[model samples]
Target: MDILQFEKQYLRLPSAIDEIHDELFDQKGIRVFVKRDDLIHPIISGNKWRKLREYIQIAQFNGYKHLISFGGAYSNHLYALAFAAKELGLASTGIIRGDELTSQSNLYLSQMESWGMNLKFISRTNYQKKLIPKEIDTTNSMIIAEGGYGKMAIKGVSYITKEINQGNFEHIICPIGTGTTYLGLCESTNNIEVHGILTLNNLKEIESNALEVGIPIQRIYDAYIFGKYAKQPEELVNFCQLFEQKHQIKIEPIYTGRMFYGLYDLIRKDKFKPESNILALHTGGLKS
Candidate 1:
């Protein structure tokens, strides 16, 4: 089956909106809702699929046979790409950071290998430069950047704004990694506020991305990163567990947990106006 057919028959587009009620939101006279992009697919879910959709389409249409991308040992982007390439009848290569790692390093890498993705482990220094293997051929290949960060990714993520009923909400917020999703929302919206909660200390990078896209980097919050990316502090882990118990929805500390924590703190600090309706995106990296 083709990419369009696979998407139509399997992937969930325009993912559902779920209203989450809390006493804190009630006290603030605000309503909080979650854009359930996680429900898009069990594997290629959330912003992963959104960011990769256009890239896959372009590869298929332009007769590219191989899809190459960069990531770490447990990269959600690489996992999604491997599965997508397998399903779409294309080849894939994952240039993984950490020369010590291999297909046996973890279950994710093993799974990617099972999906026929040629995983090449590289040194940290070489990975920083995104150097591909000398033996690997680039002919008829589409190389996607780490975490799917690029103009095509921004274009893919921008569709979220169109999927959402923007008129119903005063603000839309997401976690910023490479800033693709945040920039896309900002580029696509005019009247509604686009807020970004930093999952890592990449504020300057995100600002540069926004500037490149000709969007204002006005509403990015930097106080919530909790030292660095993938830290998984005790408080954050606890919050994620409690949140799942309360809302019956799963969230991971790396991204969604940080975003939700920041959102709650912002509400407690009275950052938003009363009666405001805010939408938080669940960008789905819940592999565990």
Candidate 2:
């Protein structure tokens, strides 16, 4: 399947970096800009949209009756996949990672199920094993890695370089989960430095993964893990709420919020020079 063909079906989101000019510079005392990939698509927005678009196209072209993927209960990827699959007339099965379900998380899960996505819950141990269920057909059905963080996920991230070229930013920073997005940006550019503010505590593993990509990543800052992925502290939540109030841009506590927090800290520690034009890629997953 030609990924370029489906590009026309989706509306390209306009960059929203202009709106936060004052807050990013004057209020934060840092020359920060944003690559608003969050607005890429209304239904399947942000990095997930970019990563999944081609995979969905491939599945359709291969005549897949069902699309099976992996994610957690509150996975933005799973949610977006459910919506995109319904739109493309394909059946979706989401293999969720955890067992715990709060009221809010369950509500979103119910919505995805209502949208015709088959929801399957597995033991956390099994989820960590990263085993693909045998019942699902791997021939025609495309299995998108959880969080879409593999090499295949880099396709969506390659678009970031085009945006950077247009803006002429000196550096790019993004929240790091599986490192696919950061690696994509690193591969797409030469001179610009790409930083990934890791949300996970185990920096060595993520750093190793980044190195495995064989791309020049400027740095990986794991100082603000906020007690691991999806586990947020009061300060992190408060910071996210305050940022939303100030910028009116809602950021998820796990990823973007931590990156923003780290960016602020870096500025406070005199890490970023005032003259440096830094671009922060808002790889939005706030809804999840």
Candidate 3:
């Protein structure tokens, strides 16, 4: 594979939006449509592609042959980056957050290794502050932040807002991990109310980061985190299963499920009156 092929997206662009016919939304006088970004690819789909697109191009343009990044044991960002690096024929190094995960075997970690990404395990303490060990030299690497949160990421994520806004939805709903997607939507849209269902509990930090980017959490739902990040309550799991059975669209408990759960909770509270058009951004990572 060459940089030219890497420059090509190699996946379907501008995914379709499916209108969900459910009484749960209809009775609330809200019309919900799901943006199927997951269909962009079987692996590198959704916001992952949006976040990485420019980074990949920049690395290739700058003559960088490697990509380095950070993530947790079950990070979809790492998963997508590993595969994207493989597809783009670029070398990658993944600095995982926990040192304990090095001894444990999991599909996510194994797949990253399979994609030829060198996996470096680090203690959570140093990982939080210093990140990777200094022995691993990344002189020619383009480093991507965890969950793809960076300035260049805003450029990629902004495309989602530009595309979704073309349909004229009153509200945009998405699951937030690093607030990069939410920030991009805020920077790109003019009239749409971007509502983020935060997957993590760091509201103060998220708001601070957004404010640093010139937009605060205008409308965010923090009640649906289910105690902490990546925790799947029994109720949320059941709701995800039932939602898949009803809508025939699979959603994992990590991101998309939490967004749907929060959306339903808001609807129950009469968040939206009748005749409100809502668009749910399905940011994918169904592998969980």
Most lDDT-accurate candidate: 1
Model 1 agreement with the true structure over 1-288: per-residue lDDT tens digits: 677799889988879999999999999999999999999999998899999989999998999999999999999999999999999999999999999998998999999999999999999999999989898889999999999999999999877888888889999989999999988888887688988999899888888877887867659999999999999999999999999999999999999999999999999999999999999999999874
lDDT (10s digit) by residue, model 3, range 1-288: 553464354776778889998887777878999999988888888899889988998998898989999988888888999999998889999899888886246888987898899999999998898466888888898988888898789888877876665556888899999988888887787778889998989778888888777764669889999999889889999999999999999999989999999998888899887888989999988764
- Best candidate according to TM-score: 1
Candidate 3 — which residues are off by over 4 angstroms?
1-9, 165-167
Question: Which residue runs of candidate 2 sit more than 4 Å off their true CA positions?
Answer: 1-10, 19-30, 99-105
TM-score, each model? 0.98, 0.87, 0.94
- What residue runs in model 1 are displaced by over 4 Å at the alpha carbon? none
Over 29-100, each residue of candidate 2 has an lDDT whose tens digit, in order, gives 556677787777765777887678667766777787677888888788888889878877888888888756
Pairwise TM-score winner, candidates 1 and 3: 1
* lDDT scores in order: 0.92, 0.76, 0.85
Descending-TM-score candidate ranking? 1, 3, 2
Task: Assess candidate 1 and give its TM-score to the true structure.
Answer: 0.98
